[model samples]
Target: MEGIIARRVIPSDNSCLFNAVGYVMDHDKTKAPELRQVIAATVASDPAKYSQAFLGKINEEYCAWILDSEKWGGAIELAILADYYEREIAAYDIQTTRCDLYGQDRKYAERVMLIYDGLHYDALVMSPFEGAPEEFDQTIFAVQKDRTIGAVESLALNFARDQQRKRSFTDTANFTLRCGVCQIGVVGQKEAVEHAQATGHVNFQEYR
Candidate 1:
């Protein structure tokens, strides 16, 4: 019998992406620091590849930024880690119910699934039964198993749809935020980034 696909929630620290990837790849959640170091080293070693034009920051600045434990990881981090690990990382978005496959063109030997709820990431696992303990979770799938991949992809979409109905994602484009440092009101992610850049205030809380 086929198993049920479910989200394995990772802690909401700034390193949720790293933690999610770590959990799926090694069943270990404490690899964030090591993974951050790996990304920094990779970018630093290949400045020609990870250029400022590509990273939106100078290569050395990006490496230093990524090394910070409080800095969040996104597409750039995902691509680097996927290439380093030599496995495809399929991220299913709850807001859009779309799967974004990293390293898809690499013909990797294996793949892992992660659930993204706008700002946070969680690992996707196959459980032997509904409500099963995470200890019974299966996080890796063979890239060659077409049947398994199809089933998991369908299940991941269904899961994302359910989460969508619950409004489990932040609408970064329209969400409101309040700066914790200056108590300034900010609208959406763009304004929040601008506020941070202008005032060097990175603390923000969502406000309904």
Candidate 2:
């Protein structure tokens, strides 16, 4: 573990390892050099043994500390890796559109909404979207506005996943209210309706 720790001639700051560790040696008394060596070796060998070693880490300086931790490389490495992966995923997803995935004809959207008859009064929960937020919100307001129902329940916004087994890509959608009463409706990117159906949700329409 010798030279595994990098030390430079730097002044001590609050966050620095030096200012945080300084000992006043008694000039009259002699201490064993082996004791100091043993302690240093133990700390370098494995860091998990020291609980106080990672305290004050949740502060704003945490990101910097995490990047500098001996077990891992610096934040610059992680940042580079993150950006690379993000660009790759974005490029791949760009070529695959929801319309192309769920089929240009959204014959399945109506059937997806029917599964929610039981959850009508609960919430019109929706996921976030790139383009469908305003449209979905307007649709929710349209379905629930000026009616004898709870105020338009706001659904969470989320990205649509291209579920393969169910084979539905829900990026843009409209859910009709049962009996045309409440306007509050949820728009999921793609319904895991098959999972729901397996639990005896009782499918009313065939998947065309």
Candidate 3:
């Protein structure tokens, strides 16, 4: 399959992109800050290259924010890290169910794997102990462009059905809830229930 054959799970704490790179490079999450530092410097070094238009409301502060261990990273950060490391990076988009390639033009033989589920990022790497694929070793995969494209499309169709099932769960992230007794508002069902149990307030209402 032109998809992730093996994987590592990055912490869901928004720094998954950088952590993924760290795993691929050193198999250490602590190295993630090194990746973040390089990326922040890359963006700060040339504002024109990563213009407001290209970054879309992302400014210098945003670059600094990316260095924060808890902040999320996106494609722009991913590309910068790939270019800095001079490695081709493959991000498997679970929502699209296909892998997207970055940094092919860079001069390095190394490759890294990242997994994105629209809202979050994770890491995927070929299993080191497993037998290598026939065409390539566990570190890399044969670049079958046509097959990858077709596979991505097919996966997208199937991914849509999966999203349908998750639609309600996804919607709840932003749906606010107000406690009737306390009048203190909160978000998500879990928190609401927790607040009710702790405060002994049973009444609740949803907001949007």
Candidate 4:
């Protein structure tokens, strides 16, 4: 159901045409109740239906980073809870007109994981994809086309990408912006450049 929220999210501009990717929150609230309401309501519907609608929306602005064929492309990043969601979501296995169990499935969810394996990876892994000069950005398209192994593994791939440019990107240089109203990832992007304006570079003065 969590993944469903992301699927078929027909973007308005019709520009990217790929998955709409944007940080769901300003901070690492991907695990917070504000967002978790959607996940929690999904798995524990006593009547087998949620009493309330989920609070999240489909990210339409920066889908490129998360799903762009040139970037991570078509592949869904997995988390540890994905394993749990997969079981819970699969247990019901019945699709409703209104439930998106997230992009989590037994196969895909297996990839969902904690920011760091032992909680040592820091928030860097969970940080939004604002200025993410991703280490493993070959995309799912490339992975499939090249018959490459581990091409879609974001964590491992990112580690490699970061390792490759260790000095330029840095271990502590994650960037983000907040959604203003929701404050998703738009706060610090005062001078930040987005997917559409790759050349815009650094803080957005208008945001300030």
Q: Is candidate 2 or candidate 3 better by TM-score?
A: 3
- Top-lDDT candidate index: 1
lDDT of 4 by residue, 34-138 (tens): 223333333343322322232122332232233223322111222213333342111001111121233333334122211221101112222224344433222
Model 2 per-residue lDDT tens digits across residues 1-208: 0111111111211112211111111111122232223333443444454234443343234343433322122222212222222210000121122211111122112100001111110112222333343223211112223221122111111112222223332232332222112222333312324333444332222221
Clashing pairs in 2: 127-157, 127-158, 128-157, 128-158, 143-183, 144-183, 170-189
Whole-model lDDT per candidate: 0.89, 0.22, 0.64, 0.26
Q: How high a TM-score does candidate 3 get? A: 0.61
lDDT of 1 at 25: 93
Ranking by lDDT: 1, 3, 4, 2
Please provide, for model 3 over 1-208, each residue's C-alpha lDDT reduced to its tens digit, 9 standing for 90 to 100.
Answer: 5443444556766577877777765666656778888988888888888777877756697687777886667778878877887777877665445567788665455566666655556555544345544233243333344423334334433543454456412334455878888789988657866897799775666666
lDDT of 3 at 105: 64
Each prediction's RMSD over C-alphas, in Å, is 1.6, 28.0, 8.2, 16.5
Candidate 4 TM-score over all chains jointly: 0.23
TM-scores, all models, native as reference: 0.94, 0.14, 0.61, 0.23
Identify the superior model by lDDT, candidate 3 or candidate 4. Answer: 3
Candidate with maximal TM-score: 1
**Model 2 — TM-score against the truth?**
0.14
> How displaced is residue 121 in candidate 3, in Å?
2.2
Which regions of candidate 1 deviate over 4 angstroms? 145-148
